[model samples]
Target: MIESDQNTVITKINRSWSVLSSNPIEFKAINGEINPDDNSYHFAIPVVFSESEPMAAVALEISKSHAVNLSVAMYGLDASDLSEDEIIDVCCEMCNVFSANVCNSFSGKNEGNINVPNKLSSEVFRYIFKGSNLERYYQAENEHGRVVIYMFDPCNYYN
Candidate 1:
C-alpha cells in the first residue's frame, strides 16, 4: 500500500504529467519499487525549484524515454519520427511544466522557471537524493518502461 504522504506526491506528479501532456498518463504510487539501473535511462533531466533559502526545494527527474513519449503525445507526433533536437525541446517543456506545478504546490503561485535542462550521464541521477530528508519515490510504467518521480525536501525539515 502507498503511504499517505507518498500518495500525495504521486498525485501531484501524475496531475502534472496529465496537465502538461495532451495525453493522459495514470501514475500509481509503487511503494518499495527499486530504482532501475542508472544505465537504463540514456538521458536524465533534473528540474529544481526553491521557494527561498533553506526551507524546502522540490526536484524532479525524468528519463529520456519517458520524456520522448511525453513529447510525442503532447505534440501529436510519432515518437520514431522526432529528431533528437525535437525530443530535447519536448523534454525541456515537460521539465518546465512539472517544475511549475510542483513549485506552485508549495508557493500557491503558478509561476516557476527551469534552469537549462541538462543531458547528463546516468551517474547524476544517483546524487539527486543525497541531501533529502523527507522523500517520496514513485514508479510508473508506460510503453517506454518505468518512469520514476521523486519528491523531497533538501533539508532535515520541510515547512
Candidate 2:
C-alpha cells in the first residue's frame, strides 16, 4: 500500500508528463464525480500493467474542450489539421506516460510493461475493469481542456 496523499499522486502524474516529453502537461483534479453514463467522449486509450499478480491498468481519455490543444501539445503539430491516426497515437502516448507515474505509487511496483493501447468507441471500460475496488479515478484539466485518468487493480475489486 502506497502511503501518499491523493494530491501528491496528482503532482506526480503532472510531473511524469513533463519528464517524459518536451511539453509538460499540467492536470488538476476535476471537482465532481465521473458520470459513468456520460458517453460524450467516445474514444479512449487503455494501458495495462502486468508486472505481478492480478495486474493493474490505466486509461486516458481527452475531453472535447482540450482535444485540439492537447493533440497539438502531444504531437507538436496543429490539431486543427491532424488525421485520426495521429490523435490515436497521441492518446496512446498519454496513457503510457500516465501509467508509469501510477505504478510508482504502488508498494510492490516493478518495471511494468504496458499493454498495447486500445482505441474504443463506447463504454467498454466498465467491462474491462469490472470488479476493481482498488481503483482511482481522476478527472483533470489543463490549459487545453480536460483529461480523465483511471487506475485500478484487477484482483482487488472487492477487497
Candidate 3:
C-alpha cells in the first residue's frame, strides 16, 4: 500500500470518480501514477481507511469495495464450470460495479465518490484475506442490477 495523505483520502473517492467517468479503464492506473500492477494498486482505494496505516487503510478499502464480507455473494463462482472468458467477464463486472459505484455514489459531494453503495459500511471489510478460487466466489444481485465480475485479476497483472 502507498502512503496516503489525510486530506486526499476524502477527496480520493471523488478523484477516482472523475477518472472513471472520463476513462474507466486507465483512470486507476494513472490517477495515482503508481506502477499500475502490483501490491501497491491495493492502495488506490480510499474508503474504509485507517488513520495512519496505509496498508490497513487499503486492505479495508479493498475488503469494502470487494465486499469481502459478502462472501456468500460468491456462492456461484465455480471456475470449473466456467470458461476462461466467462471468468474474465465476471471480473470485469466487478470492476465496473465498483468503478461506476464510486462515480455515481459521490457524483456531487466531491468527497470521494462511490455511488453504488447500498447501505455500505466499513464493517463490511473486516475479514481475513481468504484467497479465492473460482469455486469459492459468488455473486450478490444487489439492487445495483449489475452483473458480478470474476476477472483475470487485472489489478495484479496490468496490460
Best by lDDT: 2
Tens-place lDDT per residue, model 2, 1-159, is 433556787888877656544544666655445644344243333333453366666666666545555567666876578887776676666676777666555445555555666665544655554556336666655564566777665533212
Candidate 3 local accuracy as lDDT? Answer: 0.27
Per residue, candidate 1 scores C-alpha lDDT tens digits across 18-52 of: 77665556777555645545644433233334456
Give the per-residue lDDT of model 3 (tens digit) for 1-159: 132432233254345433323212111212211111121112122332223322111121222223221222343543345553443333334444554333223212233322222221323321112221111111223332212212111112111
lDDT for 51 in candidate 3 is: 32
Q: What is the TM-score of each candidate against the true structure?
A: 0.61, 0.67, 0.25
Each prediction's number of clashing residue pairs = 0, 1, 21
> Model 1: how large is the Cα RMSD against the reference?
5.6
Structure candidate 1, residue pairs in collision: none
Best by TM-score: 2
lDDT of 3 at 146: 19
Ranking of all candidate structures by their lDDT, best first: 2, 1, 3
Q: Put the candidates in TM-score order, highest first.
A: 2, 1, 3
User: Looking at candidate 2, what is the lDDT of residue 101?
Assistant: 63
Q: Model 2 clash tally?
A: 1
